[model samples]
Target chain A: MSSHADVERRLGELLRTHEEQVISRWTQSADAPRDELTELYRAILRAIEEGGRDLADLRGLLAELSRSRARAGYSPAETSKAVFGLKGALYEIVVAHADDEVLRGFIRFARLIDDLGLFTFEAYAEAREKIIMDQAEQLLELSTPVVKLWEGIVAVPLIGTLDSARTQVVMEKLLETLVETGAEHAVIDITGVPAVDTQVAQHLLKTVFAARLMGAECVISGIRPQIAHTIVTLGIEFGDIVTKSSLADALAHAFRRSGVQVSGGPATRVTVRAEQA
Target chain B: MERVPILKLGDLLIVSIQVDLDDQTVLALKEDLAEVVVARGARGVIIDISAVEIVDSFTGRMLATIAEMCRMLDAHAVVVGMRPAVAITLVELGLSLGGVRTALNLEKGVALLDHVRGAVP
Candidate 1:
């Protein structure tokens, strides 16, 4: 263990002595940007000077480098390569001196670089996971949008799979829009929804029930033939909640319920007559 | 004991619950509301809960019970101004408050009661 300490001390001395050469060589071989590589090199020197095995500063710098690279669209292998490049840079300098003790120290230094490279890989993976989580949240926000269809009427056009979290967002948004607009009617259009299982049906019923509890009636629209079939087969009863086959039909129903009369003008009637002829 | 005020507006008794309801307050409100409905011979009762922010299952049950009691006394009850969070929590707790009529605000609640009275007559 003492010899191991001795070798580590020798490596630190050699690193301090050949600082400029080591940094320049590392910059050329590493995949990282030049300015960041220089900053990291300085941190490494500071860690070595502190004279303990704790490379906390160096690890911090490396983690930051890997995270930024991950965000910049670099692959994990490329990110770790930035750390491993130091091994090749130090190997060249150690070979030039060609002493037995220095060579052992070089091996220990190479092992340290390997550990850092693995750490860089771990950091890169963590960054990618965080990016995925953020995108999922954004998708949830984007998928459920409550828009006013008419006076005293609002619509929530639901897209994608109806998970518990996404459904909660949709329900809250729909109910809030109902209160904000004083809309007595809400139409939940599910044309973009891919499938409707029992769970999705349950969520839909809950949303409608919640809206009803707020004194607003909900009209579920965009029920495709397949979904209608599935609903019947699954024995899921929507029980007194109005559902329409299309969004237009749902809006028409909402307008009718809100006592709004929608009649087309003579110009549109002439156009329809021309098309029929 | 804090009491929820019951205001008389023509044939409608408007009970606006403005405070965070505890068990005793809810029980008092129920009893007082029932008494007022009978004494005033009210045609409808509108319960406004827009100021109420939090509700557990007990409060949810009380609202339903109050509405049912008003119905038995031959007075229609409309719960109005229920916030989105409270509604969601009630639904999560599996209390749909099925027989209770709901309106967006007090004005709408009055309009709804007027409509119900018109339709029934």
Candidate 2:
């Protein structure tokens, strides 16, 4: 049987003789950059030189490799293949000179490599989590956009679930836009909200009331049949808050309040109808 | 002892709070606003809090008190130009200032005052 020192010497020899083979096989399998494949090969050889003791260095190298790949949008399968290709190259060299002791030495080496594979997987998971968090933040910003529709009218188009965090963003942005544009009327469109619950209704009411306290009247539009039914079933009361079936209806109401006569198009005939106070 | 200036335009009294008000300042303003409405026989009051960054519950009470006093004098009290952060802070504080009316800015506040003035009489 070969001693630990014997296997270590063999591993060094295996790298010296078959270094290019290891790197090429890994690069072909993982489609990784040539530089990265070279570094990974060196790290694997160093691990073997240390007699497979203290895998922290190996794990650290693999971690960095995996995290960088994750950020670059590489699949986990590709990262796995890159690390495993070193094992394939090592096994091929060992089997080529197959003897009882050297083959047994490879079994121990293979087990060590398996642990390193798990390290790469962990790095991938961590990087993926960061990506998700970044996207959620971006979505929150994009979902609520406050725009000045007319001289004295601002519109906040909301398109997503109405959680407290999102509502806070909506309220702050709406109020800021109201001041920036010096708008008297604000139209809050929630047509893209998937569903409404009492909590969401309360959030809407708070936003409306907050605007009222700032001296800007708010008109909430995009009350679809489903939302309307849900509101009634939930016993949510709007209480003097103006509601409209569509944004166009809300705009017409705002124009009437501001005394901007709309004619030659729609809102002329409907302008005569009484508005609920 | 800095006081927020209260400017009078026709029968409308405009108080634009350009500073972060403290307890003493808020109390003084509450008294001063009531005095303006009663002394000037103001038809409307627009308190603009645009430049104010934070509105704690105490400051919120001052707004409510001033609005109540204006009502007693038969003057409409409209809070205008409250900063978005201030509004969120106030709402989170659970101080809705129930009786006070609000407008987005000075121009809209004046327009609203004209509307209320016409509607009331």
Candidate 3:
């Protein structure tokens, strides 16, 4: 154990003495950029000078490098390989010296490099997971959008799998928009929703009930034939809540309930004809 | 116990709950509202909870009870100005406040009352 410590100290000294050669060799073998490798090499030397036991500084530098590489679309193998490159560079120095003490130290140093390579792999994976989470949150925001279709009417066009969390968001957004716009009518269009199970049906029912409790009427529209059949088979009752076949039907229902009349005049017909031409 | 004030507007009674409702306060408001609704022979009752932040099951039940009592007295009850969080909490708590009318705000509540009265008579 004492000899192991001695070898570790000798490896640190060897690294300092042959700093330029080690860094150049390391840079050539590493997949990372030249500047980053130089910075990481310096950080490792600083950490070694501090007592070699605390590799926190070196780990921080490696973690930062791996994170950036992860964001830049580098693969996990490539990122960890960049850290492992240090072992090969140090092994060359040990062989040149041809000393048993330095060779033992090189083995210890190789283990340290292996630990760092694993750390880099973990950091890269974490960064990739964070990116996936952020995109998922953005997708949630993008998919559930509540827009005003008319005065006293708002529409929430749901376009994905209806889960509890998504439904909760949709319900809240729709209710808030209702209060803001003073809309007595709301249209929840499920045209973009691909499937509807019992759980999805329950979520829809809860949302409608919540809207109704807030003193607004909700009309669910865009029910495809398959979804309609599924709703019947699932034995899910919408229960007095109006369901329409399309968004247009829902909007027309909303307009009728809100006392709005829509009739196309001759001027509109002429424009339609011109557009067709 | 703090009392929630009830203001009468023509044939309608407006009760806006401005404080955190404990059991006693909710009960007192229910009694006071019942008395006012009867004395005024009010055609509609609007209970506004715009400022209410938190509600337990008891308070939720009281709202429904008051609405039911008003209905028994031959008056329409409309709950108004419920915040999004309160509404969500009530929904999560499984209290749909069914059979009780709701409105977005005081103005809408009044409009709804007028509409209901017009439809009935």
Candidate 4:
């Protein structure tokens, strides 16, 4: 069993590994400028020492470190190297402590700087993921979709807002589930959604796109009036997307399309008549 | 999601998740779920999402991923206390998560897994 101390040591080692990856990539990449290497290096070291500290202290520490490095008579190039180095270290630190909100805060800060290299990509991806798993579980009691059949076609009903984080999840799940279940049609009913935003709408579109990639039909149902308005106002065309007024409607569409025969009249009367006949 | 420290539960693991279901929390969910599943060979995972108002795309994606991870590790993941609004929003957002399983509340979710021995064979 690995102890907390072991985890910490692994984090340090990860920092070194990330630094090497960053430096090696930069050295080989075409049009890679050499002016900021020193600054990056210093930033990496400072970040390591203060990686998971309090936010206020973290800011102050970074500022102080920058000033001290400047006072040490290093050239602009050297300062840049230090900063990039710090970014590389921060990248590793972010991955190691990616679950920490404090580390996420630093990633946000790094986003402000344009020259963050691959670290930015890694940080944002990790930060984005951390935000979803941690925040969603805290705020909502998210239920994982269970496979259920509606009219012989598999129906995976999702009940929640489609935020960026959850959108990615739905896309992945829909694909994997479809492959696993071998269901031809999937229905996403939204009668439970309270509101919609442009970003959330985009996430929905992405899910539809992903479902198609898996060679399955994705039907979105239960779009409320407000959601409709939001979509229209946001200039989001649901043309490529199939939508129904409600879950029932979506189910009906899916069923009809799948060539399932609708039962005539009521079940009780039909059973009695059949027995008598 | 608000993440509490890992709570040991005999052979099970209970991690209380705050209701913030966003991108960052999703990453945490993946990390925590992976670690818990891999290290302890957790028999059951109880995810408390009662605080969440909405399950965004990234969040939805991460949840699916966690469920998949649990199944791979011969464990079951039970999502507890999803708000009605959150559920509705996810549907409207057109997120289709298949293969993930859920229980209405923590008690049921946990109970459902207590008698089970992992993923369906």
Q: What is the C-alpha lDDT of each candidate?
A: 0.89, 0.83, 0.87, 0.60
Alpha carbon deviation, residue B91, candidate 1 (Å): 1.3
Q: How good is the docking of model 3, by CAPRI class?
A: medium
Instruction: Write model 1 residue lDDT over A61-102, tens digit each, in one string.
Output: 888988788779888898888788888888888989888778
State each candidate's clash count.
Answer: 0, 6, 1, 103
TM value for model 3 = 0.91
DockQ, per model, reads 0.91, 0.59, 0.78, 0.02
User: In candidate 1, which residue pairs clash?
Assistant: none
Off by over 4 Å in 1: A1-9, A24-36, A52-56, A67-74, A92-108, A264-277
Q: How should the candidates be ordered by lDDT, best one leading?
A: 1, 3, 2, 4
Please give the distance, in angstroms, between residue A242's alpha carbon in candidate 4 and its true position after superposition. Answer: 1.7
Ranking by DockQ: 1, 3, 2, 4
Q: Interface RMSD (Å), each candidate? A: 0.5, 1.4, 0.9, 10.7
TM per candidate comes to 0.89, 0.75, 0.91, 0.34
TM-scores for chain A, candidates in order?
A: 0.83, 0.70, 0.88, 0.45
Give one digit per residue, the lDDT tens place, for model 2 in A1-277.
5588887777677676888876777677767888977987788788788787877877888888998887788887778767777677677778788877667667777787777777788888887898899999999999888987787888888897899999988988888777677787999998899999999999999998778777788999999999999999999999889999999999989999877887667734554667889
Query: How good is the docking of model 3, as DockQ?
Result: 0.78
Scored by TM against the true chain B, the candidates give 0.98, 0.95, 0.98, 0.83
* Candidate 1 global TM-score: 0.89
Q: Candidate 2 falls in which docking quality class?
A: medium
Count clashing pairs, candidate 1: 0
lDDT of candidate 1 at residue A56, scale 0 to 100? 81
